[model samples]
Target: MNLELLESFGQNYPEEADGTLDCISMALTCTFNSWSRDGHKLVSASTDNIVSQWDVLSGDCDQRFRFPSPILKVQYHPRDQNKVLVCPMKSAPVMLTLSDSKHVVLP
Candidate 1:
């Protein structure tokens, strides 16, 4: 299967709280609780421990990021969009480098 990133402003719906937390690709049922804009690109986070990036012109998700814990909010660095701030519900916010996923600077 192709692993292309697909994300954008998605409408959310309520679902039964099952025994598991989804951390996979979000179809239309994913609800974005927090979001931030970086030029023409959009970055958003949800309760599914996923962070997705989308192109504004086409409304297509270009990439999806995963975290160990559920994401509460996300923000793009003011100077560099590649550097993202991921705030988890149970942990401190981390500054992640999208290119390598190596950095974990404390927030």
Candidate 2:
């Protein structure tokens, strides 16, 4: 599938110099981890220890979650949409709730 850029937002923080906010002395630090569900919504985890939920059609971030460590991978539950699994680079996968953005490590 082909995708086009619509809008851009700063990762981790809204007022950061991510080229979208501060264009004078910019720093493009946010990188994509390639995690998507169909073509409607996607989850992007950056090196800033942040996971962002995106709306494919509108190119808007619907929600944001801050993890304890930098997120390595993100996956949605097979049977549950509200529950997501986020794996940090130095640790195991943790359960994340989409409603409140609460994350709990699985034992």
Highest TM-score model number: 2
For candidate 2, give the lDDT of residue 78: 68
For 1-107, candidate 2 gives per-residue lDDT tens digits of 43434445545465656565446764535555434446577777877788888878898998888877877778777666676788887787898888787888887
Off by over 4 Å in 2: 1-38
Candidate 2 positional error at 47, Å: 1.1
Q: Assess candidate 1 and give its TM-score to the true structure.
A: 0.58
The lDDT, on a scale of 0 to 1, for candidate 2 is: 0.74
Q: Indicate the residue-level lDDT of 83 in model 1.
A: 79
Q: For model 2, state the Cα shift of residue 65 in Å.
A: 1.0
* Candidate 1: tens digits of C-alpha lDDT, residues 29-73: 344533444368777776667888777889998778777887767
Measured against the true structure, the TM-scores of the candidates, in listed sequence, are 0.58, 0.62
